[model samples]
Target chain A: MANSKRTLAALVYNRPGVLNRVASLFRRRGFNIESIAVGRTDDPKLSRMTIVVIGDNATVEQVRKQLDKIVDVVKIIDITGDDMVSRELALVRVKATTATRAEIVQMVNIFRGAIIDVGSNTLVIEVTGDEDKIDSLLNLLRSYGIREVARTGRVAMTRGGTIGSIKAEEEAATGRQR
Target chain B: MKLSGARMLCQALINEGVDVIFGFPGGSVLPLYDVLPEFQGLRHILVRHEQGAAHAADGYARATGKVGVCLATSGPGATNLVTGIANAHLDSSPVVAITGQVARAFIGKDAFQEVDITGITLPITKHNYLIMNASDIGSVVKEAFHLARTGRPGPVLLDIPRDVFVEEAEFNYPDKVELTGYKPIHQGHPAQIKRAAELINSSECPVIIAGRGIIISDACEQLRELVEKSQIPVATTLLGMGGFPGTHVLSLGMLGMHGTAYANMAIQNSDLVICLGSRFDDRATGKVSAFAPAAKIVHVDIDAAEIGKNVRVDVPIVGDLKVVLQVLNTLVNSKSRPAWLEQIQKYQREHPLCVSSEEDKLLPQHVISQIYELTGGDATIVTGVGQNQMWCAQHFLYTRPKTLISSGGLGTMGFELPAAIGAKVGCPKETVWCIAGDGGFQMTMQELATAVQDKVAVKIAILNNGYLGMVRQWQELFYDKRYVGTPLWSPDFVKIAEAYGIPACRVKNKKDVSAAITTALSYDGSYLIDFMVEPEENVYPMVPPGASLAELMEHPDARRANASSTFTVSNV
Candidate 1:
C-alpha cells in the first residue's frame, strides 16, 4: 500500500461552479490533491481539468469513481500507468546579484528554460517539462535564494491511445486501458 | 403567449404532474405566491416553518415515490430547509427545493434578507441552479426535477432571484433533457452478474443485505424472488426494513447497531454477502475491516462511487436494483439452505428479539407494538431520531414498501411530525402514524399547528421517556451513568396538542396504552397521545462503537438472568 502519484484528466461541462464541485468533492471525500490545472478543451462547451493526487491504487480508483459521479464531469481518464506524455509549466524567480546572474543563466540554459523577467535583485525563469525537470531546476536555484515560484500542476495525455473513450474510462480502475 | 417567470415555473410543475406543494411565503417570494391563485390545479399547504415544509416534502416523496416539492423565501427561510435537504440527500430521496433570492440588483450588497443559498446548499444537493435570467426558468425547473428523481434520487434546488420572478418571458417547456454526464447505469454488466451468480452458487452460507435501493427501484418483488429462489437469508439496513417482508421465513431483521442478534450473527457467519442498492454506511458495517470477514462481498448499486467506498467488493455490479435483480434472478442457481436456515433458527431461539414487559409501567416497545397491533401493521409509520426511532423499527413489523418512513441517514430529530404530515397528505386514504420521543418531539412541536391547519389526520404517538433516552443509555453504559444534558424539561405534550386543536390524551400505564391507540386510530381528524414510558429502557443487542458485528452486548435483563451469555465487559 505505497502511495504513488496519479494523474487524471477530466472533461467537464464548462459551467459556473463546476470547478468548485470537483474540488469540493475531493476535499469532502478525504482525498488529498497534490496539484490541479484547468483549461478549455477543443469542445466549446467542455473544459479539460488535469488533477494530480497521491494515494494508493485502491484509494485513487475510488477517487476516479467519485469524480466521475459529478454531474458536470463528462468523463475521466486516469493516465497514471499508461504510456503517456506529461508536462508542467513553472515560473520561478531567484534572488540575484550581478555575480550570481550568469551562473543562474547557465543553469537555465542547461534545463532549456527561458528568463521571463528580470528585476534589480531577481531573475524570473520559466520552465516547461515534467515535474522532475522543474523540481531539479528549482532545487538548483534554492541555494541562490529562490524568491517566488508558481507551478502549474502537470497535465497529461496518453502517448498514442484514444483517450476519453468508454473503454478507457471503464479500464481506468482496472489499470489496463492503454 | 408570454408569461411571467412565476407563471412559467408554476406551469412547468403542473405539466410535471405536481398537484401539491409544501411551502411558506415571505418577502422575496411574493411574486411566486401572487400567481398561485391563477393555477387552480396547484394546491399549496402553508407550513408553520420552512423546515417543516422541507420535511413534509421529503415524507411525501418517500411515501409516494415522486419528487417532493418545497418552497421558501430568502436567507433564514432557505437556511431552515438545510437539515431537511440534507436528510433527503443522505437517504437518497427525490426532493426539489425552490427558494427565492433577493432582487438581482440587490444581490451581494448585503441586501436585506439575502443569503448565498445556492452556495450553502451546493454540497448537500445533487445539483443546484441559480436563475439569473427570466427565460431560464422553465428549463431549470425541468432539469431540477430531472436530476432530483433520476440517477440515484436526491434533493435538488433552484434559487430564483426576486427580479426573475416578475420579469416576463415567452414560456416553452422542454420535453427532454440532454445531460451527457448524468446517465445512471441501469443494467448490470452480463459478465459481472454471471460472476456474482457463480459466487452465490459456490457459497454454503450467504446473507443478502437488502438496502433502500430495493424500495427506491421498486424491486422488492424481485428481491423476494431472489431470496426464495436462491434460499439466501435476508438482513436489512434500517431504511431497508420494508424491502423484505419482516415475517418472511428468510428475513433476518435489520442488521448493525440496534439490530437483531440473529441478524448480526448471521452476517458475522456469512460466507457470501450480497449487498443491493444500499451503500455500506458506517452504521451498517461495524469495524469495517472485521465486518463479515469470511464473506466475499458482491455489491450491487446504481452509483459506482458506493461500490468500494466502505468495504471492498469482490464482484461489483452497478445498476438499478430492479433491473439488476431481474437479470440476477435468472442466473442464480436454485439451492436448498436447510443447514443455514436451521442454524439461524437456533440463533433466533437462543437470542430472541423481545421486549421486557411490565404489568405496571408502559415501555416504549409496548407503545409501538400496541400501535402495530391496533393498526394491524398497515400504517405508514414515521419516527424522529433516538430511542423511539429504534423501538419503532424493532417493534413494528413492516411488510410493504413505503410503509416505514423515518429519517434514517441524517438521524434528524423532529422529522416525525412534519414528515408524517407530508405522508398523510400524500396518501390520504392510508393511516399514518408519527412515533416520536419526548426529546425529539419538542424540537419541532410547532408543526402540530400545521397538521391541524392542513387537516392531515396524522396520528401522533409520543414516547415520553423524560430524557434523550439514547444518549442516556450510552451514558449509563459507557460514561458511569453521569446524566448531564440528556434530561429534558418540557411542557405537557397533551396540553400542547390540545392547543393545536387536535384531540389529545396522555397515557401513563400499560393498560391505558391500548385505548389511547384505539381512540387515535378511529378519530376522524388528527389525534395525539403522550405515552409516558419507562425512561431508562435501553435498545439492546447493540454493536458497540468500533466493534465488529460479532461482538454485541445483549439485553441487560438477559445478561442478569443468563450467566453464560456473551456479554463482554470491555464495552462497559
Candidate 2:
C-alpha cells in the first residue's frame, strides 16, 4: 500500500495537533502515509507538510478531500499528479577496517554521499537524492558490508517554480482566521 | 544487632509477597531450606523432581499473573529446571527461579554438586544475577522480583552460592526498588490518542481487534466501552478469549487459525481495523499478504517493536492499551451501523461451530460441556495440547480471566496435570479441573504424587483415547490416515492414581460419567477420572493448518446445523 506515485503537499498552522489530524486521515483509510515531512515553510505561523502516499486515483482524490475537511489542514495538493522534484536522506554504517576501508570510501564518493564519520572498524556514510539514486547507492555500498541503516524516506516539492513557498504563505493567511 | 544471611533471604521473600514456592533440596540449598522452617506464612511444595518444581512454579505464574518462584540445589538439582525455565522464557511467563551454588571458596574449582546455573540460563532469562556476597542477597532478590514483573514481564534468575546463605550479615531490606535501565513507558502521547480517535471517526467501516494485552493491562472495561460507544465490533485472540464476553453484541468471538468465521470476516471486510495489544502473529493473520487485505490498520501496543513487525500499521501508537482505549472511547461518537453488524451476524449464524453427533460414542465437545456442567462454569479448567485443548477452549464457558489456563503461545503438550496442581494451589477455594489427552497425561503423570502429597485435591479428567488425539486427527484429515507413531496402548490410570494414594475412577460407558465425576469432586483427596472417548473423533470447525479464516471447514455432523446437538455421549 505504501508503494505509490502520488505526492501531497499540505499546509497547516504551526501547532502540535496538526500532524495528528493528517496521520489519522491516512490511518483510518488504511493507506500508508509513506513519507511525511513537516517544517516551517518560510512562514513562522504555519508548517508545510509533504506527504508521499500510496493509493489508487480515486483513493488519492478522496484523501485530499478528507484532509481539506480536517480543521488544522489549510490546503492539500496532489503533486504526483503534476511534475515534482523529490529527494530523501539516508545514513548507512558499513563494517570496515583497514583491510577494505579504502575501497568502500571510493564507492561512497561515486554515489555523491559523504563519509560522515569513521571509527576504528566502522564507516558511516550520509547520502541524499531521489528514491532511484538512493537505491542505486545502497546497492553499490552493500559489498563492503552494511551494518545498520536509517532512511528519511521521500519528501518532494514542485519542480521549476517556488509553488510550495507561495502555497505556504497563502495557507497561513487563512489559518489565522479559524 | 546482627543477622544471618539465611534469615535475610527469608525476610526478602516475605517482602516480595511470595506466598508459595516449589523446590527440592540438596547439600548446597540445605541451609536455606533449614531457614524456611522459621519463616511463617510461606508454604513450599517439595516436588519429586527439580524439573517438576520449576514447572509447578511456571504453572503458578501463568495461572496467576504474579511472579512464580522455584528453588533447587546445585548441579543436577539446578540443571533440572532448564526445561521449565526454557518453557517459561518462550511463553513470556513471569518466574523468578532461585538456585543454590557451591560455597564461594569452591566456586569454579569443579566442586561437588556445583554447576554454573546463571551462565546456563543467561540466554533464556531476561536478566540474571549471581550473588557472591551475603550482604547483597536481599537487594538482588528484590531486584529479581521487580524485573520479572515489569515491562513485557519474563522470567529472571538468581543463583546464590552456599557460603552467602550461611554467612552472617547486617540485613537492611529496602522498602522501595529503583532500577535505572528498566523503566517501561506506559502513558502514550496525547497527540497520538487524538490522532487515533480522528482516524476512527473518519473511517466508514471500522473493526476493533483486541488481544491479551487488554487483560494484562486491566483495560478490558475501557476497551469494551470504546468498542461499544464507537459502535465497533471486537474480535479477540486466543489468549484473549474472555477479554470481552462472547455474549456481547459486538463480541466477535476468537479470530485466528481456528477462529469463528464472523470475526475473520469482520476484519476482512472492514475499511479500517483498530488493533489493541495484539501482535499480528502468523496464526492471527494467516498469510499476512491476504489478511485484512481491505483495511487500513491502526495499532496500539506497549512495545514499539511489535508495531509494523507483522501487519504494517498506518498509525502506530506505542502506549498502554487501557489508556489509549479509554481516550478513544471518550472522544469518538457512538454510532452503530446495523447493516454492517447484520452482515457479520449472518456469517456467525451460517458458519457456527459444529459439535460432534450425539450418537458418536466419545466426542470431546460432549466431554468438555459435561465437565463444565458438572463444575458449574466456576471451576478453573486447564488443558494439554491438541484436540482436548481446542475442545475445552471451544465448549467450556469461562467468565473470568486466568480461569481458562492452557499453553497458548508454546502449545506445549503435557501441561495439564502439573499446571492444574499449580492452579489448585493458587486458588484453593475454586474447583480445579485438568482436561488432558492420553499422550499429554503421561509426560508429567509422575507429578500425581505432588497433588497427593500436597493434598491439593484437584480433579484430573483424562480423555483417554489411546492415541495422540490432535496429531492423529490431523493425519486423518490431511495425511490420509497414515497415523505414524500416534497410536499407543494406554496404561491403567485409575490404578496409577490409586498408587499415589489419590482416588481413581474409570468410565467406559455413558452412565458411569456422572458417578465418576461425582466421586472425583466429592472425594476429600485428589481424584483421577478416565473416560475412554472415541479414538476416531476429531475437533471439528477446524481451519486447516496454515489456512485462512475464510477457509474454515465445518464439522461433518448434520445435527450441528440445527444447534440441537445435546452434549450427551456414553461415558462408560
Candidate with the greatest DockQ versus the true structure: 1
**Candidate 2 local lDDT, residue B463:** 92
lDDT for each residue of candidate 2 in A17-115, tens digit (9 for 90 to 100): 468657876877798877888888666867878888778766677667656544345667788866777888999999898989998889888888899
Native interface contacts kept by each candidate, as a fraction: 0.68, 0.00
The CA lDDT at B115 in model 2 is 88
Query: On residues B370-416, what C-alpha lDDT tens digit does candidate 2 reach at each position?
Result: 78778777778888888888777677766676777777776777778
Give the CAPRI class of candidate 1: acceptable
Q: Positional deviation of B379 in candidate 2, in angstroms? A: 1.5
- lDDT of model number 2: 0.78
- Native interface contact recovery, model 1: 0.68
TM-score of chain B of each: 0.97, 0.93
Write down the worst ten-residue block by lDDT for model 1 chain B.
B563-572
lDDT of 1 by residue, B1-572 (tens): 88999999999999887988899999999999999999998889999899999999999999999999999999999999999999999999999999999999999898999999888898899999989988998888888899999879999999999989999998978888867778899999999999999999989999999999999999999999999999999999999989999879888888999888889999999999999988988888899999999999999999998998899789999999898889989999999989999999888767767555334678888788889889898989999998998888788889998999989899999999999999988899989999999988888889988888778899999899899999999999999999999998879888888888988999988888999999998899999998888989998778888999899988766644344433221110
State the C-alpha lDDT per candidate.
Answer: 0.88, 0.78
